[model samples]
Target: MKKVVITGIGTVNSIAKNCEEFVKGLKDMKIGIDKITQFDTTDHKVKIAAEIKDFDPQKYLDKKTAKRYDRFLQLAIAASDEAIKDSGLENDGEWKENAAVIIGSGIGGFKTLYHEFHVMEKKGPKFVSPFLIPMMIADMASGVVSIKHQLKGPNFTTVSACASAVHSIISSVMLIKSGEVDVAITGGSEAVIDPMPIAAFANMTALSQRNDEPQKASRPFDKERDGFVMGEGAGVLVLESEEHAKARGAKIYGYIAGYGMTGDAYHISQTDPEGTGAARAIKNALDMAKIDPSEVDLINCHATSTPVGDKSEVRAIRNVFGKNATNPIMQSTKTLIGHSLGAAGAVELIASILESQNEFAHGMPNLDNPDEEMKDLNIPKETKNQRIDVVLKNSFGFGGHNASLIFVRD
Candidate 1:
């Protein structure tokens, strides 16, 4: 069987703008949620979010090229640049013709799209920006990454709401394992911190109204939690087959041993209360990895903090591991970075890889009181240092999408 491994990782998130800071932010338990500054929130009930700070696209592309892409595309390009540099791929023989780029986004170029629609409505199509169409498409991230990096393999976007990024990782692994591509620039990116999405989600009551305490708003397994706090950023990973990585002398962060994807088929916007689908997904991943539940020492859970979402995930964990489930160090990075939506899985995957390397798991903040349903799990409210061998990252998204990826410390 072909083995897949992560050769490099890059990120741009609310708490950190690069890979090093991202890992440190997670370890230090830094929360990035805050009042919205991208636009005024006076008239909005939900005024808080986790926005990327001090981002300048000039770092990735020249001004002329920057203007052609939107913020989401800019983030994708920057992260991809970092990942490629980190991999030191230039030293390897030419890879432009066989490498692939597979990036995902839940809402791509939302800011540009929203702005363009208003421009067209007010000033007509003649006045609308010509770059709107290309900048607003979700697949542009993958396309731009491929074009910029000169990678000529499979390139496309996978959209499954919050599960989008992780889905890309799974798909990338398959492509490499099947002898389709030797290298893949894969992950997710988003920049929908604008007013349009905030209002739409707020009206759906999918946002927390903790305008007074933004940092405490994304309380994932706590009874005090109301809803998720929106966040924006990009996470890009360089995945290569073990043979290719070893041949090129690339640094191996960890091994992508197995993955499982399943849909609830129950609801478009709601999770099955019984956690039937989530459990099956978890079981499928474990089976693929050929390990029992007890082997996994940590789980980066998909606790989005939504009322229904949190409970369903916990139930799924419990159903899969039963009493032994309490042994793993399970927690949510969302408690610190809010929900990055599509980019979340890749971001949290970074944390998982870091924990696998550092042999420690970060604690969950604002979780002073774990909900009764989640109290049984071994979610340390404080950071704990332990030798970790196997870690699983769960990403359950809207539309009943559930994806689980298993990584073994290698």
Candidate 2:
């Protein structure tokens, strides 16, 4: 099997527009959650979210093309453009034919779908836009990206709720390792911060109702944590086989050492109380990496600030790491950027890679005071400089999907 290395990374989130800025924000412990402003949330119980402010799609794509694609696809293209350019793969003689794209989204164009449905109900079915279907489907992001870059190799999308991005990235690594593609632009995007979706999630009690203190609402591992704050953004990475990267003189960020995935078979929207499936996924990833749990330096947890979800993840970590379970530095970036849903894994993975590159583990913002129940592990409250060689990222999603990825410094 060919070794797979991450050559480039890009992200557009509530915190930053690119990887450099994103890492800086993470290290600074900046929180991006704010009162919802994208739509009217007058009737919703939750009225806050982590929204990308003042983003101009025209900066990445032409106005004409930008109008046709949904916000999620626009964000994906913007991030992919940065990743491709950073990889130096856009050159005329580069491995264009051997490159592919795999981007995923949990709920693609929910805003578009909601708006179109309203238009059809009020203005009649004939008034609906003809581009509605293409604009709302989850796979269109990859399709548009492939066309934008003229990548003629394998291209598709994955959908697994919050685990969608990690699954897509893992699949990309497999493609390269199997010698089917030399390079792949892999990531995920989400733009579901609209009023209808927010209301729906709120009705289901899945979102935080701390409307007064939006910035401090997403307090992962804290006893006061109520629920996750919905966030909108995209994250993308340029992945290539180690041999191909070396031949092209590309700068490697890190290697995707291992990947593991499992299904809980317990609940559709809730995690198993014992975290049995999640622990298995973590063990599988470490086993594939041929490393012991003690070797993991840092973990970017998928604790979405929900009461049950946070504890479940902690239990899983303890089960896998055993004696060193509480020793590894762990932080939840979701406290700062809220939950990006489908894009959570990709965004968290980007943060983890940057943490390894900078040799710094960021503190969990707004989590300085955790309850005894949530304090079983060492949760750093301040960014600390450390030699981080290996990092693990965990992402569990709706429908019992669990995925883990291990990234090792190059």
Best candidate (score: lDDT): 2
Please, what is the TM-score per model?
Answer: 0.98, 0.98
- Each prediction's number of clashing residue pairs: 0, 0
How well does candidate 1 match the true structure in TM-score terms?
0.98
| Full-model lDDT for every candidate | 0.89, 0.91
For model 2, the local distance difference test gives 0.91
The reply for model 1, stretches above 4 Å from the true place, is 90-93
Q: On residues 1-410, what C-alpha lDDT tens digit does candidate 1 reach at each position?
A: 68999988888888888878877888899999988889988898899999888899998899999998999999998888888888788555487789889999998999999998999999898999989989999999999998887888899999999999999999999999999998999999988988878998889888899899999999889998899999988889999999988986778887888899999999888889888898988989999999789899999998888888889998898898887788889989999888888999998898888778888899987897788988878888888899888988999888999999899888
lDDT of 2 by residue, 209-246 (tens): 99999888999998888999999899999999999999
- Summing lDDT over every window of 10 consecutive residues in candidate 1, give the lowest-scoring window: 87-96
lDDT of 1: 0.89
